[model samples]
Target chain A: MDHLSILENKSIFIIREAYYRFRNIAMLWSVGKDSTTLLWLVRKAFFGKVPFPVIHIDTTYKFPEMYAFRDEYAKKWGLNLIVGSNEGQVAAGMGPKKGSKLDCCNELKTNALKQIIEKNGFKALLLGIRRDEHGIRAKERVFSPRDDNFKWDYENQPAELWDQYKSTAEEDNHFRVHPILHMTELDIWKYIKRENIPITELYLSKEGKRYRSIGCLPCCSPVESAASSIDEIIHELETTHTSERAGRAQDKEDAYTMQKLRSLGYM
Target chain B: MQDQKTKCMVIGLDGVSQTLLSDYIEKGYLPGFKNILDSGFRLHQMDASIPDVSSTSWTSFMTGVNPGEHGIFGFMDLRPGTYKMFFPSSKDVKAPAIWEIIGQTSGGKGSTLHDKYREGIRRPLKSVVLNIPQTYPALPLNGVLTAGFVCPDLKNGTYPESAYNYLKSIGYLSDVDAQKAVEDRDAFFDELFLALDRRAEAFEHFMDNSEWDLFVSVITETDRLHHFFFDAARDEKNPVNKTFISFYKKMDEVIGRLYARFMEITGGQGLFITMSDHGFTVLEKEVYVNSWLREEGLLKINAVRDYYEGIEFGTKAFAMDPSRFYVNAEGRYPAGSVKGSDKKAVVADLKDRLLSLEYDGRHVIKAVYGNAEIYNGPAAASGPDLVCVANDGFDLKGTLKKEGVFGKGNFSGMHTRHDAHCILPASIEPGGRLHIEALAGFMLDKLLIQKPQRR
Candidate 1:
């Protein structure tokens, strides 16, 4: 099959596998291109109906446009929306400015996410993480599991073979599910075009700059680019010297800075 | 004594620590591991061979030899005779793994002529190799494979069509962000375990549906996590922290699930082997080696108009700790500036000065290891003039950070020559630490049941 078909088929398999393995599962919808694309795949996997909830961890710091897009699409796709936020942290007056990037991330993003998992009693969370985004990412497994506290044990992971994924984990804790771990930037764009998935406006270049990665507005910066369309971004990735996360402030703080933050629970 | 013939399904944990595991197990935190230990042997420590890198350890594990004999050294080497960084890959391994020796002779499909044949066939055995370091540009083995860290481009590897379909079915389209998602990762290991589960399921499915003798897989998630999450696991205030205890426990669950699936797929007919390339240790501080070199007069350089008066022109090159420099001898300097005899004297003096100098209120450079002392022959000749093993926590500063500690963009945490960034292998054999090299050997031994002469 062609590359797009190949990608479509792979995502379908992972979704189906997750549906079969986990009784209570949800998809984290960041309202970005990756999650929106995941929404499309979910629709396809379930014959135009997402049988699980689409969780949006609202840190309350997302751009205004994100909410609008999320609401519009949640209704358009008839998605089961589960919005989560760390009200305590926000009430405590925390933002990207208050704590270190590491601290801020944990409080605003990871804490909110952990609370959601615990409160809702989710067993699996479908994320849209791909492996090409970072050096550390290149070392991931397709079916990774987390502990009770959501700590990722990199040293010990399951051996995933072929298409048959082993999704069993401990009693009731949730597992981080990545359905599109292998597709490259080009492949994602191709599938987006093929499926005509709706994306956020932030993806388009504004004044000759574009956000390669979408995060809380304060911490995420736009790179110098004019690739407003999906195709242009793909071409930019093919030729650019900069990394996808180059605009991310946290990564620039230290070489092992990302590691330290992630070890603690930062997404 | 452990039976040598019991089958093993080795799983390599890139940077695991036996000490760390023991500490957690003692606390009764890791139930999955507690179960494994209850049933199998729990050796306290597995002595890792030298040069403790992924490729060297993996090579040694498969060949039952040290990096010295296998010819696979550190991550970067000099191509033959040049002073450059040489990365070890499948191309650099010179010796025949036990798999090759057995696979070739059994079915007459492989030959001793380590040519195109070695690159094309997985020998006469059926193996599934995934994410093993240095096995990039995956040789067309008789089984399946997903290349390791240096596999140039990961998307191009020969993954099953179903793998891609799984990505699409989950609402991830082929977009830049989606593609970037898979690529951009940290020690966020839960996702990695998921990947391994998917891979293992496929492997087990193949093992059950088809007739395959050897099944092998490697995961990079552990190595990535140790580099990133070690602190988070312990950080009480950090919202995203992962404790060292919880991390291994999570992995244990995945391992447990993997074992169950393997048993179901293979009907308990296969052995499992698990291992790590090396082990990991926590770093406490960073010592800038270059700063001390500048302090001593062994090296010469023109400081930015602020420091002491600029030194006269001389031959010198700067690197991290244990700063190394040489007089501009032949084409680099004016003739008679430092005659041949002076060159020898300078070298000797510089060596003594470096060994005795201190930096950062500490003995900056430890005992200096030369090629003859630390490296050997082809490998040593291609390495740095002197391999400086800085004191613990001392790291070599980049060229940009020339002035002092905490340069404008300097961030600390680094790997040492002996830092325990390793894993515990997954094998069906007895419970013990299996080296990365033994992964291949174990696979061959199980697949080729009939003992045969070496290829």
Candidate 2:
């Protein structure tokens, strides 16, 4: 079979495996191309219906376009959407202006996710994190176990050789499932185009600028590209030397910042 | 490599087919394999994937699943619905690998996230894995690991930060540079032998250092040797024949030593399995899959843009590497003009024609499988409508740009899915004719290896 089929099959298998093995499982949707493609895979895996709830960690600092896209697709896909926020921190004015990018992300994204996990009692949370996206994420396994606090131990990942992924979370501890961890950014875009998957308009080029990596508005930046279409974005990824997260402020703080944030429970 | 043995060890001899090994064993060259057979250990012909490649076959061996389940069909796969290609890594494997299952039972959520919420590090049986294909950026297994082919760097391929230093201190080379091999023939042999020696040493060191349940190490030199000097092994008069046999003899010695050490360590009670992903044969012709499809008026393209971008609408069908053919039905391809109702008919017609394809009176394709027959999973929607399994001598090539339909090309050898040899202890009966997937269950069953504990 073609490479795409292999990639898609493996991911769907992982997602389905998680579906059967883990109870109280929810998918983390960032509403970006990768996660949207993941949602598309969920639909494909489940035959047009998303059996589980989709958790959207709304930091409230997202691009207006992102929120709009989220709402539209959530309704269109008939999604059981759960909006998560660090309401306590958001009320206390915890954001970029109050702290560093990593701190803000922790308070807004990670902590919000932690709260939602506790509130929903989700045992396994499916994510769309890919290995090629960043160095810190490159070390991830398919069935990544997260503590109740939501931190990721990048160093001591389990040995994953066979098709058998560990379903570690029992009763209360958290487990993060990345069905698309093997996919590259280019592969995501290609899948997006193939499935005709939708994304926020922010990714499309406007005035020769496109959001290669999408995140909260204050920290996220677009790159110079004329990739007005998914096809174009895919073409550009073939030869581009710049990392996918080049425009994200959290990454630019320092090389180790991502590793640290990840260690401290940051997505 | 490691003289110390464990309870269960998988010795992978890549590309050593039934025909070649049997022929060599008959000549007293492969005494190690012969010993296994003579000791009442049966060599089951493990059926690999249709377009058997190391990446997929090894994965099947470790995962106990087909490509449809594991999702690794070849060394490189095109991005879904796009013509662009990407090499799949270990993370791409959706199914749990043998080592991962072993690790899962052991404990420690790979993510540090568990450190705060979870208590205790559960120690399962340790698995010292080495040089398995498609396993890159190795994660911490129960024991140690050094990844195999397509590993870009030693540091990235090794688990535990210190393994890199160990490998580096020993002057270990991951793989032989094929280009340099072409430039200097003698240098290639030196590097090949040296890499093999170092890999053996590293595996030995890890095995000796740790007490483990499962140990697997693959020797990929057979594949490399076959790719270049396959004809030499077949032709007795070739200058490289003696050299190839000597190398095979060296392999026999290594395996002999490993077998003896394994017996010594396990007190002759451990299960030792020697297997290969696929067998090797001489490449007779290179059949350009895409160009052939183009000839059949299945694809329409213009050269003004890139290969993928060049595809035009009304493209009924197309093919990818090593015999993956897709019917461009509506809702699948962006510019697809073929109706969904016509897909089966198109696939049938394509299969009929493909089966009839002949090169100089010899059949090019032996069989054409519809997706429904081969793919038995939810991800079948993404697969090719038909898979063209080529005849033994016909090396199927998939490139928009090719010299011709079927003739001489780059390599001297090709991969065959059938006739792959699997040597396991007679105590573990694999029912009858076994496929690569059965090896996993056998490894788990008779070996008494279990997956990681669920909680």
Candidate 3:
């Protein structure tokens, strides 16, 4: 077996475990390369069918091409797609500018997610979060349970060893299942190239810069690269030393803000 | 009891196996370890992880996961979809170490929360890690961090920059000059003892200086000493054996002082643990994996004679260091020869041949693991399709420069999968069979408590 196949098998096993474990589970689809590869793995895990909802949190600030890609694949795959948004907050002008950036993120993304979880009663949410994407996420478990009020107790998390996950959530608090938590950003692009996973054009080099990681259009920027094709991206990542999240504005807000957002239930 | 501050320490002795330790203890040469045995729960015999390379084993120990999970298989890994080999750094590790998962304190050791960049500060450090492998170019750990073997140099290996000055002031050496070790034995021993001496100083320096919940320090001299002087180091009559015993005595003293100080700091309420990434054994023969493959008509090469650079259209399979193998699968590589359909049979046949391999009337190879049998992760795709574990005394080498299957190298010792042991607090018994990765969970279970108040 090849390295990619081993990765695929483990991911497929995790996806199957999620399917078997969670009663009301959904996958968070960011339409990025990582999440899309995750969606492909999800499909592959269930033998070409995603048994649970594919939830896309439309912050109303995402790249336009992302929305187009989402709709195209969602329809093509016959997905049980759930497009969510902070529409109420967006209507009241909730964004990075309203008071502090952290507060705005909480209002726009975390609060919106909280509302969706409550409305849909999602007991567990599978995210495409990879440890290499951010410093804080490095500590995340394959199955991370949120405390009451959706708080992430980062200082103390449960011990998940040998695929034995003690998935006990606080009342009304859901579990965050990261199927790709152990993957690096490089692994995602490689997996994408291997599986032919669909991704937004925003990732491809435009002029000279390409977005390494995508979040909201306002907070995300691109790095200087000529990696227009998937092969080039893989080759570039082999030598590239810069972080994937370097261009994320929210990350620049402060080193601690990502932890703060995560604690507040933000992805 | 309620007022006892939480604390724990993991002392990583690079290659001192339970077998070796038992021999040393029988000679009354390891009083420090003897004390640990009398006090704590000795694991008797904990197996090393698969492949049993120092980097992968320590990584498994730290992350509580196998190579398939933590994504570090050996000292080096081939870049995905390319034949290019890259050193696997701590950054390449996909899973978090216990320190990473526990939330690091702000790099600022004493900065008041309200007065500084208030953006992020984790639970005030509960840990200090020093001289551990796969931790080169040390991450900005919450507490102090000084990396171990394969650390590029003194500057890049130590973290927080503050620790760098202290290291520089004492002229602390991070690792032995490995190249120098091979070329000059006398110089190697001198550098080795100096580095060992400084390592203890650094450990003492940090433990005395830093406040922590957990403290870890791994000594790598045992591994290096065994590698160069394995057979002689054990023989009491050998001239260099005195130097070896002297070094062990020095280490025993270091361990004694460290345990005493650490226990004092912990107020008798902490876990003081000791372990090794893997064990050491005599290197009777070195098996050149690629050369063996070429002889078996499995691998073909061109004039360059390099594994990747010399490959041509006719290549069927190849080998990587520490006994990892890969097939030339098309669609995965640009000019890969093997199609996806024949991969299973091809790998299985390869495994069978490897298992049957022998030299000097001895089964040179103990086991051949299909990547599926050993690993399960995304990076596993990029790994060698097959990993061959050699029997004791038969070291596996990936050097394509060798002319035959059997050869002798300068190395006298090689890594072993058995004999790796650990000592944990007596209160914690992980019970039944155990591997190196189990210790991480044991320590985690110890620290599992009411959440630390958020900064």
- Residue A114, candidate 1: C-alpha displacement in angstroms: 51
Worst 10 residues of 3 chain B by lDDT: B108-117
* B317-372: candidate 2 lDDT, tens digit per residue: 87766678878778766667689789878988888889888889989988888877
- Under CAPRI classification, how is model 3 graded? incorrect
Could you tell me the TM-score of chain A in candidate 2? 0.90
**What lDDT tens digits, residue by residue, belong to model 2 across residues A92-186?**
99889874565688789888888877777778889998988765566789998876556577665777878878776655567888999988888
**Model 2 misplaced regions, further than 4 Å:** A1-267, B1-6, B105-123, B303-306, B449-455
lDDT of 3 by residue, B1-455 (tens): 22134567889999888788778878999888788778755646678987888888998888777677678877656666766545677778766777765544323222121222223223444567998988876877767788886665556778778888999999888767554556677898899889889989989988888766678899988888888777876788877788888888889899989988877876767778888888888889888888888998877766332246565565678887677788988876645888889888889889888888888678988888888887776556666788877889998887666798887766778888887877776677667766887776666555644433355
Taking all chains together, each candidate's TM-score versus the true structure is 0.48, 0.61, 0.60
**Which of 1 and 3 is the better model by DockQ?**
1
Residue-level lDDT tens digits of model 1 in B19-102: 556666777767766665665434334544444555566666655544544566544343442222234566566555544443
Please give me the DockQ of candidate 2 compared with the native complex. 0.01
